[model samples]
Target: MYNRIILKLSGEALAGEKSGVNFDNDVIKAIVGQIKKIVSNGTEVALVIGGGNFWRGRSADSKMDRCKADQIGMLATVMNAIYVADFLNQDGVEAVVQTPFKCGTMTEEFSKASALNHLKNGRVVIFAGGLGHPMFSTDTITALRGAELEADALFFAKNVDGVYDSDPNENPNAKKIDEIKCEDIIKNNLKVIDLTAASLCFEQKIPVVIFGLNEENSIVRAVGGQKLGTIVTV
Candidate 1:
């Protein structure tokens, strides 16, 4: 089992297949239930959320300034982090939201020391804001935080079950890869993660698991070392 892990969540996953809703209460609760289960098992958890539900930097506004779009996207993540944090608290998990930009009581400013302290005290730390810079994905922050926090693995919970040779949505014959290496991911340009983040994970030697969060008991199984999805290592 993973002693410490960074759960990387996409904003769209929080919507939980519910259209026209900012968030799904039941879905969030279910996710929290998984977290609670893992925490009870004595595993340390941290979160990195994406802003795809509200805004995706390159897709939201093609004509807008890149930096501005990324900043707005970053704020979207803060919104997600707070929502998840609130649910975790309601579910009895001690949670805190830390961001690079000040949200003025909405959340605390992020510091390595403070975040580590919270984790040490058994509080779930939700990391918001993507590297506090433009042109960077939350995936990048996943690698950064996973390395800084010394997490055993990075759990990338996504829409798909695992990494595939082709887009499953387009090709019915797409094959799911159970395990792979970071070198193969980059060489094939598989799009499992951004090049920068993938490279960082490779350099840091941080193991990664890409799996579908929608699967029943996915988080629980993933953290329990069940080998749910594509496992990426050195």
Candidate 2:
């Protein structure tokens, strides 16, 4: 089992399959339950949640300034972190939201030391605000935080079960890659993660697991080394 891990959750996973809703309570609760199980087993966890559920900067109108749109995207992540942290706390799990930028008293400013301290003390640390800058996705933040915190592995709780040779939705013959290297992922330009994030994971020698959030107890199983999805290694 991984002693510590950084779990990257896409905002869309929080929304599940619901349309016109910011969150799916059942999905969030199920995820929280799995997290609680892992924590009780003594595995430390930190999280980086994406903002695609609320907004995607790249999907914004062309008339909007790119930087401004990204700023709004960053704020959307903060909102997600706040909601998840609150839900975790309410479920009797201690969780804290940390941001790269200030959120007036809503969240703590992120620092490697502080985040590590929280994990060591059994508090779940949620890193939000997407590196506090534009042109950076939360995937990049996940790799960065995993490196900074020396996590045993990075867990990507995505909508898909694993990385595939082609888009599974489009190609019926697309094969799920059970294991892969970061260099190959980058060289082949796979969509498992952005190039920037994959490069960082390679440089830092961080192992990553990508799994479907909808799978039963996926997070817990992934951390326990069950090989529920694709495993990416340096």
Candidate 3:
């Protein structure tokens, strides 16, 4: 459980009940509805979401240079941020979408001071665009943002239920870990979080919650102190 937290959502989760490369209003509204419950309970929130639903740079780089694809991925994240910010506004929650990379029309430039000011004002901040650089995933951004915000915990909402010894979908008998130390995670080379992200949390001692986004009430369960997922701590 955490007081103030950073939530990392993958883009595919925003796709709603269809298979496509576009934004879904109903899905956004549903996410906002869930978040409202937490904010009403006086929790400070920040988020970092990926853009895999629209475009995953690596997957599209058949002819494009790696750097170009990564830049395209960053832009995709900015697009998601704009959509999220607009949806939050419609939900009556003051949300600020900030990016480490400059996207004047979509969001403000990211700065810890500005983000803090917004949080102090009870505004939910959506950090997007993955540290304004290429080659790093949003997971890395989540860990860095967690440290910068001094968040009690980082919630990673993935498609899987929790950290497994192997891909749960691929390996039906993969062991799900309820709790584990960060060092062991690295030593075992578990992909629960990337090495960079895990190293940051390991150094900072911030707990990371890995849970399935598809699970009903999973986000609330994590925020409500329910031990329903794999927790990585050191």
Q: Quick one: best TM-score, which candidate? A: 2
Measured on C-alpha atoms, candidate 1 has an lDDT of 0.91
Per residue, candidate 3 scores C-alpha lDDT tens digits across 30-62 of 788777777777788898989988888769558
lDDT-best of 1 and 3 = 1
RMSDs, each prediction? Answer: 1.0, 0.9, 1.4
Regions more than 4 Å wrong, model 2: none
lDDT of each: 0.91, 0.92, 0.85
lDDT digits (tens) for residues 1-234 of candidate 1: 778999999999888878998798898899999999998898999999998888877685579899998999999999999999989998899999998888898999989999988988889999998888998899999999999989999999989999999999999999999999999999998898888899999999999999999899999999898979899987
Question: How much RMSD separates candidate 2 from the native structure?
Answer: 0.9
> Which ranges in model 1 have alpha carbons more than 4 Å from their true place?
58-60
TM-score of decoy 1 = 0.97
Which residue pairs show backbone clashes in model 2? none
- The TM-scores of all predictions, comma-separated, are 0.97, 0.98, 0.95
Which is the better candidate, 2 or 3, if ranked by TM-score? Answer: 2
Residue by residue across 1-234, what tens digits does model 2's lDDT show? 788999999999899899999999999999998889999899999989998899988585878888899999999999999999999999999999999888999999999999889998999999999888899889999999999999999999988899999999999999999999999999999988989999999999998899988888889899998978899988
Ten-residue region with minimum lDDT total, candidate 1: 53-62
